[model samples]
Target: MDEKEVPSLAEIHIAASHLRSMSLPITPILTSSILNTLTGRNIYLKCENFQRTGSFKSRGALNAVLNAMKIDPNLKGFVTHSSGNHGQALSYAASIVKRPCVVVVPRGTPKNKTDAIEHYGAELVICEPTPASRTSTCLQISQERDFLIIPPFDHPDVIAGQGTIAVELLEQVPDLDAILVPVSGGGLISGIALYAKRINPNIRIFACTPEGKMLEECLNKQERLWPEPPQFLNTKCEACRLQQCGSLTFPIMCSLVEKQVFTVSDKTMIDATRFAFERLKLVVELAAGLSLGAIISQSDRLDSNIRNIALILCGGNIDLNEKLPWQQ
Candidate 1:
């Protein structure tokens, strides 16, 4: 499959079938009491944090890894670059199929995540914590070893795997006016908008980012990609903070996502993370907070008529023993 093109609906359905065979059933979408009260709109949380490997990333990793080995039995192991959650996910998935996996992560990744990757028995290579460095390291290793690369985002099978969330969301809720998804490389949102828009065009999809997304550049259809940040923001959203969005993700986002991509502050994200812990009794990761944070900070700008909203709590790979950011 061409890496640049957006995945078709049929491709997503095929990936869903592969996933179901592995016993990866649909995750639950629960109504959050505190969040609903806070937003004045019925807020449903798609709790992917409870998913296998503690993140939605498992869906894509398993799909891509399993499908590859299934096609070519003699294929070598997998390689990938991740900030945190995806590394753990790929490592866990590779362990399932008894394949050696190598993950290149940025330096200073949360110990909890790196520990999980090691626990899954993958070799971890820590590099300079930048998008370029991570990609370069991973690509170099993959090319040198002739191993299949399981991307965190920005691939056909991977995108389709993530799309399964939207398929389940519609089935669970039936009717949702708007959905706020945390966007890092745009994989999740692209996969989501692909299905949500296909099923019901009326459902609005918003990409929530912790950094200050330039509205003009983001909305420019010709650009079809996130502008490279001059300097990465110091945010606890470890899964995000990339220099720019993925090429495959950008095109889909440009076509399907709502024009106004919501940007929230790091403080708002931290507060949202704390809110989920204290109020909802859910241990959500910092990157997942972008969805909830956008709502809290931009409540006035949201559609007044929106009755039902969905938020994807994407991961919970936090170090339980580590002090919460608010405590410091």
Candidate 2:
């Protein structure tokens, strides 16, 4: 769906109001010295690490589920395949509404990811870490059990819900020049770009994917009659390394966004991770640190006059003990 066709400003205001009524915590933190020092720009870290279920996925999940609940009071079940955070978000949402959940997780997904889902009382189904298998497994289960598919980053409601982040950011930093967001399936970035651009067409929305991932190519392919699957490039940022971008997100990003796609080495993610722990005094996972890494990698590209910037800290659900490849 053309994000433009999805909702009007007046309609979006009502949607945003409905989301706010859920009482989910929205955090917009202004703390990032390294980013400031590197780019000579005032940076605000939208610290969504403190969000419910410890990630921004909660925003999209709740929006999808509650909206689904409104349509179908007896929502049969909930289902999704995620690397980590999104699964936990869906499971937590399911628990709140007392619905059964079946999560299809990649085989190598961290133990903590599975644990969180189970803790929320959702059944876990593990599959190979590939886009084909993830989709296939989720479809199979959804067919058998009649579960509502809550895609990680690929639905209109989910993207608009995630856009609420940009809504809060624009309110928090009215003069914000740029916003950096991590790109796994493009839900968060799509949402942010849609609303931010609708408000101020000049705001640049950067897509920060794992190093070497062909996100720029993926975004372009989104315009075709039969768009190809996202070309998966393997990297140590497992949480953010998707085989492809989401179908719904890809098209919206290609049409609406003007920002270029950039990448940071696993090393930058590691350093940024440590930086968040040491300097920001927060426990952020590799996915959360990608925004910092993107700013660091593209520090030279940004105009020095661009003083106000925003980075979306997406999640913090990694197993702290497991040595990420960058750490070693």
Candidate 3:
């Protein structure tokens, strides 16, 4: 998509309004006394885990689905590839409109998430655990079945849909000094940064990632570079296992988001997840825990002027039956 086509603040507002009309919950901005005390700053959590489909992916999926239906009412169905959350969200969104949906999920995806995708009425197709495999399978299915592809990220409408979170976040906490977002394919942060910076130029936007150099390297080189294969698939942060950033999302991040990306280890994310559950009484996936981990372990790196920070807990889809990260 054209750089000029990046979703504007007005577009994000429209997405927020559309989501409200769809009866999507405006997830609350929660604050924890314990977290604030630990961080020495007012910390707010934008709990997208409470969102429909148990993640913010629902906002983008539904927006894209509704927009596609509006433009082509006769569309056969929808198709997309996801590690888990986006597939469930897309399936849920498609079911609301009584449309057939197909989800191309990567192999080794948690069974709980795949079960939820099927429960939401999407036909699940498993592929190799690689970005290339996911994209190829999705494309093949889309072509063969004449399905509309609502990508998990990298699309303008989807990015705009994710941007709706920023609209809600800024409205709820207008004076936030910084916003910490977990980055995967970059859709969520791209949307948030695009709108948040326009609203408050001084508000810092931080991208928290698994302890990998893809995002950091990309930012440093000022270009997208897919280094050697990432070990994301082997990590506990399955929701953010994308090997590289999205084409559309990277440029947006390069321009609007903080230059320095925060990288967190799997252990740190697991510890953060445990902390959230034990103290904050919140269930967060490892990916969501990345932001919390950064705030907990890397607060000193933040600018001195930053005080109030908002962390986007992007999802809460973990298999409790499985050995929890801390247990292992």
Candidate No. with top lDDT:
3
* Candidate 3: pairs in clash: none
Model 3, stretches more than 4 Å misplaced?
1-3, 228-234
lDDT of 2 by residue, 1-328 (tens): 5646454455445557767887877686767666678767888999888888888998888788888998999879999987578888899888878999999988886677788888888899999988799999999999999999998887777877788888888888878888888888788888888888889998888888786666776566654332356565567676686656666777777877654676778778878888778788887888878888777667777777667888888887767667754557
Error of 3 at 147 (Å): 0.4
Residue 124, candidate 2: how far off, in angstroms?
1.3
Q: Mind giving the per-residue lDDT tens digits that candidate 1 earns over 1-328?
A: 1434767777788878888888886888877776777788898899999998889999889888888988998887899987577888899888878989999987887777788888888999888977689879999989998878988888877888899898889988967998989988778888888888988999999888876555336556547344344345566677786646677877787778888878888888899989889888888888778888888778667889888899999998777786887786
Ranking by lDDT: 3, 1, 2
Which residue pairs in candidate 1 collide?
none
User: Which one is best on TM-score?
Assistant: 3
The TM-score ranking, best first, is 3, 1, 2
Score every model by TM-score.
Answer: 0.92, 0.90, 0.95
Error of 1 at 82 (Å): 2.0
What pairs collide in candidate 2?
none
